[model samples]
Target: MSSSTQHLLVATAALGAVAWLVGVAVITIGIARARNAGDPDATVARARRMRTVTLALTVPGAILVAAAGGWYVLGRDLSIDPNWWIGTALATWLVTTFGSTFGRARQLSLAADRAGEHGTDDEDAQWRIRRVDLIARGELLLLVVAVVVVVLQPTAPL
Candidate 1:
């Protein structure tokens, strides 16, 4: 690929990753706040919206990651060992974060839906919402570690 094309691909990947991360963070915060309002209908609405948004973000994220020139870490200019560790940390963080949040959000959506239909607060849904927060926070901690790994450029001792 031409130098300009490579630069463009990298820039696009950076833009896409930033958008995805920020979008997820904002949406997760919104969902966390909505869950505490004690309104089943609103909570259900938020949960359903979250599911749609999550999938939307994920599809683009996957495409962007793929288009990142076949993993820039493996590029000839970079040292494979150090870059590989950072890349793995980042990849793991993204996958686990999304998996836990989506799983919890789905459960919350279902429970909240039932509660909305019945016109009563659902303990199950509320519990699930709390779990979502817990999971998000946990993943965020992992994200911090990933960030540090990237910044530190950790590599296995030879």
Candidate 2:
């Protein structure tokens, strides 16, 4: 790819990452609002949508990063061993996607099962708390991997 194209790809990847982070924030806020409102239906729907938004954010972000990496390797004419970086990014994507959905499904299912209930029981609350924790951990791991990839990539002049 041309230098200008590479620069554009980098900028796009950066924007995607930023957008993903923002989406995660929105999801967190939605979760909090759901819990505060004490509406299990809203909570369930929000949780499902949160996972969807996360995927919407991360998939494109990962693709952009991969494209940028490929461009870097090609543009620099380096003997780039992309396995570790690619593998790490893939792992981050897989874990974030699967983990978020799995965790949220549990919470949402429980909430739906107990909808029209009087109060939030300890078990349901605990499930939601755990789900949030799991999602947070997965996102943190993804962020760490993404930062490492960006910082550690070979940036020699083409």
Candidate 3:
């Protein structure tokens, strides 16, 4: 790859990494606040906002990462066997995106149902909060793995 292309890839990857880190931090803070909040409605609102911000960061970041990686791979000579790292990174990204989306939808639906019923019981609310936290943590882990794979450019024998 040309020096310019290499620099571009690095820059894009760095931005994506920063975004991922920020998203993780936001989710973590939201989780903490939700756990301590007295009102379920407030907790759900905060969580929804946080989830939206996290998704905003994640989708563009994933796109940039994928584009940079794809460019790097395609720019190389075709005679070479494809590296497994790219596939792994792509799969991780897909898993993170899909898993988070599904989890968020479920959490929101449950929260809405709880709100409509005006239930005071903390048991169900706590369970939903924990579920959201687990989902965010899982996504964060996958994002970290994907970043490492892309940045380190590790390879496996084809």
> Per-residue alpha-carbon lDDT of model 3 for 58-124, expressed as tens digits?
5666667667766766776422336667777768867876777335645655754665566534567
Off by over 4 Å in 2: 77-133, 148-158
Candidate lDDT values, in order: 0.60, 0.59, 0.68
Q: How do the residues 17-75 of candidate 1 rate in per-residue lDDT, one tens digit apiece?
A: 55556545755786777767867667666767766665677346545645673555445
The residue pairs that clash in candidate 1, if any, are: none
For candidate 3, which ten residues in a row score worst on lDDT? 76-85
TM-score, per-candidate, Cα-based: 0.67, 0.56, 0.72
Off by over 4 Å in 3: 36-42, 77-82, 101-126, 156-158
After TM-score superposition, the amount by which residue 50's alpha carbon in candidate 1 deviates from its true location, in angstroms, is: 1.5
Of the two candidates 1 and 2, the one with more favorable lDDT, higher being better, is 1
lDDT by residue for model 2 (1-158), tens:
67788778668767766665566566667777776787655665666666666567655655565566556656756453544554555566567656663345455445544543533444664366446745765675576666677557544333
Residue 91 CA error for candidate 2 (Å)? Answer: 6.5
TM-score of 2: 0.56
Best first by TM-score, ranked? 3, 1, 2
Best by lDDT: 3
Off by over 4 Å in 1: 66-69, 77-80, 88-94, 101-109, 116-120, 144-158
